[model samples]
Target: MTDHVDVLIVGAGLSGIGAAHHIQAALPERTYAILEARDAIGGTWDLFRYPGVRSDSDMHTLGYRFRPWTQAKAIADGPSILRYIRDTATEAGIDRHIRFGHRVVRAEWSSENARWTVEAVHDGKPVHLAASFLYVCSGYYRYDAGHTPHFPGIERFGGTLVHPQHWPADLDYTGKQVVVIGSGATAVTIVPAMADRAAHVTMLQRSPTYIASLPAEDPIANRLRRLVGVRRAYPITRWKNVALSTLIYQLSRRRPQVMKSMIRKGAVQQLPPGYDIDTHFTPRYQPWDQRLCVAPDGDLFTAIRNGRASVVTDHITEFSETGLRLESGAELEADIVITATGLRLLAFGGIQLTVDGRDITPPETMAYKGMMLSGVPNFAFTIGYTNASWTLKADLVSEYVVRLLRHLDTHGYDQCVPTNADPGLTEQPLLDFQAGYVLRSIDEFPKAGSRAPWRLGMSYAHDVLKLRYGRVDDGVLRCQRRPTRDAAIPAES
Candidate 1:
């Protein structure tokens, strides 16, 4: 099947939906197609289904500016969030434009035609699409497959193995001992939820992660949302939430002892051992250096404090039938094992782009405000940070992309590529923090220069100011004539 559109959007998640909304609203006449890999929509939100999965970031910044979340819960669970994505897509009429089963295998740029030839598979059938511009909203990496350590006897274990990403909805764990591996957010979320029904839950971690337990719902904020629309109320709500979060984060940084004390209280309540608190509750790094996992209503910590769950801070030696063997020769038996390892990050499908047959290595290319790749014409990607909600950055990037598209259309120009080639330029990591995802995919992902049009800013206010209202003629973007063949669609497949 051969389809032609002015724009091709991959991934029907928050960013892709936002991009479609902007395009449909600003340029209704322009034709576009959204190609999603999954059979259904909602990228990451739809993918993860661990026991107590919810947003760590508040809904104010997590939601789109165009669409405000009216729910009373500031921190919502997975189902509600997925519904919100679906509702937004439907409300904006973006759902109908999506090709749900389409997965893009590879996309190659044709300099002669000044267009991208996107090749994808739709329901076991080949589909070809060509677009004047390509907007990639596919998320940073593969869905969390719950990193399973290669325990020596894992294959022989009698218990069921589960990764948070592929959790079975109907799997019963009640009255069964469960061992959850890894101290990441997914593992933390699963421990408490499983503790409610399981006979016992044990959390195993090599090193502790900084965890903050807070209320599930904010009373005053919920009231404000109910009284005023999300758009009008969001400012106060976001600022208030961010301010409090920032304060706690600062306290955890400046006074780890205080934070540590608070954590001990929460942990000892559930588990009666004084030594256990030091083992699983104490992290190696300062708070907020990595992401701080949030358990709404303090459920995870509360469960620990009440003796419903136990934490073991030790490396695993290997798997044993009906249980796990620790490095200290200790065996913990469980009916089910959940691996909450982390996700593997991939940048642009690890695709190597050659503009005019020149390799456009991501690290060598400048990221124009973390959206538009410098030297690539009419292309943008949606990337968020560990600090803020993914959509906050994505919404701004979507708007900027639409703005750039409109500017090109109005000026009667096409083929907008950044050709500023400085061979002597050095590349560096966008964020200073040491995150596995960022570090692993840094080379594959486009590099952000230390200055404007190359630097990646995680701040929402700064991005809004730059991407929303920044002048088009910033001397970084080079817009020129659309090749004569660009208007002509590729030959039918």
Candidate 2:
């Protein structure tokens, strides 16, 4: 079947839903549709079903800027988050516009046609659609698989081996020994959570990662909600959290030694009296060098103190019949092994892009405003901040897209392409983050520049000024009108 829309949005996750809300509210005349590959509303939330899964960042900044996060827990669980997403979809009537099971494989842009011809597969049948603009919100990581390195002798392990991305429903670990590998957000969350039912839970990491403790509920936010209404308190609390996070990130970057000392001191206060904090808690890199793992109210530490969970710092020589054998001549016994290693980075949802029959290579292009790509007309991809809440940058990108669409309508322009005219521009990695997933696949994504409108955003306040209020017709982005021999385009009311 063939379909046409003023805008075509990919992935009905947090960003896509938020984008639809902004576009529908501002430009009600513009027809839009969301193509979700999954059958559910919550993208990441629905995909991951591991025990004790929750948001690493607080919900205030992670939640939609337009919508108020009225929940008590600032660090919400997976089910709560999924419910929130579903509620948002239903409240906005955004679910009605979603085309589920539509896996978009390719998008072709035609200059003469002044639109994108999108090809997708739905229920094993080919589907065709056209749109004036394409907004990709499918996120950066691969949903189908998580990164699990080759563990020597993995086949010999008798117990169950699983990846957190695809957690099994029927699998039970009650009163069973569990060993989780890696020290990322997923591992920290799983270690404490599984400790309740497991005989013992151990987090085995090759090296240490920075793990910070945050309160599960924000006292200031709760008080404000009681004093004022939810809607009014939301923005205030959101900004407060944003400011606090920004300050931490900035301080960590500027004063690495001071921040590291502070973090170590905090860990010393939480763990046992004579615990080996140096071996298990100390990271070689500076704070925020890689993304810091969040531990709500020091639950991970509590689990360790109570002898429910423990941390092992060593390299895995190989997998044994019972568990993992470390290089330090130590063996860990386990009934279940959870590889919370990391995610595999995928570019543009692995969708092929062609412009006038010529393939568009992401690595060859430059990111414009960290959303739009250079020379890629009417195309934008939402990539959030690595240091802060993802939704912070995502909301900005959505607003920017809406503003750009409005500008196009105002000028009667058919195309707006961002061109990097500067010949002496220096190229850099799109994300400065040193996470294993990013390091493994950074070359597959677009490059960032050393200057403004080309460099990726790490600060929410800076993006607010740039994306929210900045001129849509910035010198870099060129707007043009071309004669199109096709059906009449919709006129502004």
Candidate 3:
């Protein structure tokens, strides 16, 4: 017999745990279960074991709104994040409801029964479960493997190659010359981290990315916490960070050259007087064309200034026997090569979905309110903002979902779906970011219309007003009751 639940949430990550908390708080009567593919909690945090792994966004904003981050450091490491997630689950008694090692393969929704029959693999066996509503919080990327671009003659390199996503626990890099490929967040993080122990570390990139140096501990937040306590300090700090991030993003979009100059100037100040900032620190593209890389306390620049690390802005033509041969005919010799490439985005954790025996492809549908998809019934997915802290959008999404569920319960509706009514509406890519990972997978994801309710506003302020306080019965979202046998039957025939 298939176990029935009011809601079935996929993934036990930061989003899933937060979703559970919201559901338990708002719709206490509805029973739900979280299915985690991994053997433990903390989806991304637990999965990524790379050195110097930490949140790019500060804890004040990254942390859930319901919970206050009591840590002194705004930029928290992976283990600390994992502990925070685990502790939240433990305190909320959400840990008991999570079924680890359960990987959902397919979800079939039947309008007749108004339920989703979810099939998953657990402990090398097939398990079936049914739910009234399905929530996808599995995150946006493939966890099994990261996107590692093939290099010419990569096999000829006689050195240890590592991807930050799958960093080996037992591997030793002490006194070794390390070459890290790609200039994204991972490369910047690993360069400074490995530089501390390695003989030397080099960050090799085809082009440059805008790098920002921020204090690990936020002084304003620290002062506020001491004065007003953590509970009050959190929201204040979160809003301040949100406004600052929004202002920067807005400036970058509106005045690209001005923002670009500002970012370059910041990077230049951190480097040595005669350092080639134009060649190494300056990016070809404007600031925020791709997400800016943040190095807490100018760590990456500090390492480079102290001669422990270096930056090479050049393309890799091919891999040499010892290391890489650049397009400029320069050779980089290294004992270990870390490929901090990027992630391959996966929609709905690659779980196949069907609506009453009809296959449903995410790319074919349009996003509704950035939470639910068009033509999808009783289903919602949490996708965070690219411009700001992910949890800021995540928390709003969770709150909106709870509000939606409660509306259904109050109205006695079995299903609610956002159908695209306007044929004239122009479709756009869900994300506007030009990051490599986003560009690689944008076609595979859903589209958003040019108008509101159909379009995704990447602003937290906009989302809060629309998602949190907006009416649930807004004309586009159609709610209906399940058809019963009696209702389908003719009175007299």
Task: Give the TM-scores of the predictions, in the order they appear.
Answer: 0.90, 0.97, 0.97
Please write out the lDDT profile of model 2 over residues 148-228, one tens digit for every residue: 999999999999999999999998999999999999999999999999999999999999998888899999999999999
Candidate 2 residue runs with Cα over 4 Å from true position: 485-493
Report the lDDT tens digits of candidate 3 across residue range 1-493: 2399999999999999999999998888889999999999999999999889998899999999999998889998999999999999999999999999999999999988989999999988999999999999999999999999989999999999999889899989999989999999989888999999999999999888899998999999999999999889999999999999999999999999988888777788889888998888888887787888899999999999899999999999999889999999999998999999999999999999999898999899999998898888999999998888888988999999998888887877888989898979999999888999999999999998899888888899988899899999988998888776336632210
Clashing pairs in 2: none
lDDT to native, each model: 0.77, 0.92, 0.91
Query: What are the candidates' C-alpha RMSDs?
Result: 4.3, 2.5, 2.5
Candidate 1 lDDT, 259-325, residue by residue in tens = 7777667656545555556667777776667787877887877777777887888888888888888
Instruction: Identify the superior model by lDDT, candidate 1 or candidate 2.
Output: 2
lDDT of 2: 0.92
